[model samples]
Target: MPAINAIAADKLVRLLGTPRSPAMIDIRNDAEFDAEPRLIPGAVRRAFTSIPDWAPDFGDASVIVVCNDGGAAGHGAAAWLRQAGADADVLDGGVIGWVGSGHPLLDTAAVPPRDAAGRTLWVTRARPKVDRIACPWLIRRFVDPHAMFLFVPAPEVAGVAARMGATPFDIEDAAVRWTHDGELCTFDVMVEGFGLGAVDGLARLAAIVRGADTGRPNLVPEAAGLLAISLGLSRMYPDDLEQLDAGIAVYDALYRWCRDATDETHDWTSHKPAKSRVRA
Candidate 1:
């Protein structure tokens, strides 16, 4: 069994793609990290020695500290974070344990450079309907929880990205690596690029997103519903950021459905009385 302040790898996996997941902090030393540049999904690299400066930044939020082997570094960082009043825990086996459990690791190379505040910034075309919103949702849930996005005029996306130090995505620019490839939408590219294709439900979700964004809703039964909802959301919110904020919840629900509820079905008769069922 794991220690009281340590969470098992399998248990942590359940929380990874959810909004309630704790802030994941990777405190592996330079040499250890150089050996394996990937990170647990949604994890950010932090220096264990610098906990004094950053621990308070978490405030009362929950945190999970990860190290090379779930040894002194992780436990020590968690202890320091607790002292600073943040609720923190160590991963039971750290990166080693996480890998041993056959969980997926995010390819750190695919992520764009972060700003000084450690948030990945992205720029995209304004008035988003599908892929634009879906990409941000994927990035926040699986890559960088604190990522920021800039929505600009389609013509200005590239210039804004260059000037503002943000990565441009989902546009027609050939230079943009995050755009669609053939029939795949930007969401599909990101899932594959970030090494998240193996993540359960994401591939299915990507298909839905692709079908919705590319006017190919016939690709999946759920794609038509996603497109309808995405268009409705775009009409409801004129402000791009507000629309994105709302769309995030939509993707969250869709992801959960794809992951856990795909095998289940519901109808008016699901909760009907036994007498009504017998009569039917």
Candidate 2:
């Protein structure tokens, strides 16, 4: 059993893709981080020595502290965060344990530069349907939990991205860093780029995203359903931001279903239909 103060890595992995996921704080010392240079999915690096300075900024959300191990560093950081009136816990066994258990880790070097507010900014076409909404969900859930999104008119996407130093995605410009690559949707590119393809649920979710975004519904069982909902969401909200906000919840449900309940089935029958004893 996990200790009262620590959460198991498997349980945390289940929570990582949802909006209710705790804020993951990597408090590993510089030397240790320099060796691996990757991050737990959705985790942000914070100097362990400066928890007092940074702890106050996390008041809006609960926090999880990760160190080299679930030892003194993480436990102490969680203690300090709790003292500061935030719900906090240490990741049981930290980075090593996460790796040991074969959970996916994001390649932090592929992350875009953060703005002054310490959030990644991404610009994409307004009136998003599938891929655009899915990409933001991936970023928020696994890449940068605090990433910012900017939705502009389709014609102005590249210009706004350039002026604001935001990465433009799901647009059709050869110069843009995040456009479609051949047959793959932007969602597929992101999954490959971030090294998240190893995640079984995310891989399944990616196939659905690709099929929905690329007009290839035959590729995945859920693609047609996702495409319908995404298109409906686009029509429902005139404000692009509102549409994206609502779409996040849709993807959240799909992700959780993929992760936890993919094999589960239901029917009206209390037990398997009487093997049909057909008038033998």
Candidate 3:
């Protein structure tokens, strides 16, 4: 059995895609990572030697520390994080346990460059309705939990991205790598690109996003409703970032519904019993 102080990989997997997910820190050494360069989904790499330098940065947030096999590295980091006044835990078996459980891992090589603060910066068209919001939601939740977005005029997306060093996305340009790919929408591309396809619910949500964003509502039954809600949200908020902040909750609900509540139905009398079995 694993140590009681650590959480199982399965439990952490379910938490990874949600807002309540703890800050995940992978503290594997260079030689260990050279043998396996993948990262647990939604996890960021931190040098074990620099724990003192970075531990204070996450003083207010809970953290999960991971190493090769739940040895001295993760233990030391968790201790440092706790010493810094943050709630922290170690992975039960570290990356080995995570991979052994068949959980998803992301290819770190495919991830875009991060800014000074370790956030992936992105630019997209302003006045987002569906694709733009959904793509950011996907990126923030699954790809880079600390992703940054800048909304600009459609004509200036590429220019702003070049000048500001942000990756341009959800806009049409042959040079851009994050746009729609033929039949798939930006959300679909993002989900696939970030190696999140293992989650069947997210894949279904991607279809809905594609249909909603691409004017192909017939492809998914929920597409029209999503589009309607997205447009309404856009109208409600004048600030693009405010709209995105709201959209994050929207997609969060949608993702949970897709993941856990799709087959569920509700009625006022769900708790009420039938009329004594028809008085038989």
Q: Is candidate 1 or candidate 2 better by lDDT?
A: 1
- True lDDT of residue 31, candidate 1: 96
Q: Give the candidates in order of TM-score, highest first.
A: 1, 3, 2
The alpha-carbon lDDT assigned to residue 263 of candidate 3 equals: 90
Error of 3 at 215 (Å): 0.8
Highest TM-score scorer: 1
**Stretches of candidate 2 exceeding 4 Å from the true structure:** 270-280
lDDT of 2 by residue, 164-255 (tens): 99998999888876769988899989999998888758888988998998989888889999999999999999998899899999999998
Better of 1 and 3 by TM-score: 1
> Per-residue lDDT of 1-280 in model 3, one digit per residue for the tens?
6675577888888887789989899999999999889888788999998888989988868899989998777888898899899898899899988888888888787789999999999999999999899988887887789899999999999889989899999898977878999998888887788777886489889989988999988888999999999999999999999999999999999999888889987676544576633342
User: How far in Å is the alpha carbon of 139 misplaced in model 3?
Assistant: 1.2
For model 2 the TM-score comes to: 0.92
User: What C-alpha lDDT, on a 0 to 100 scale, does residue 213 get in candidate 3?
Assistant: 90
Sorted by lDDT (best first), the order is: 1, 2, 3
Which residue pairs of candidate 2 clash? none
Q: Which ten residues in a row are the worst by lDDT in model 2?
A: 270-279
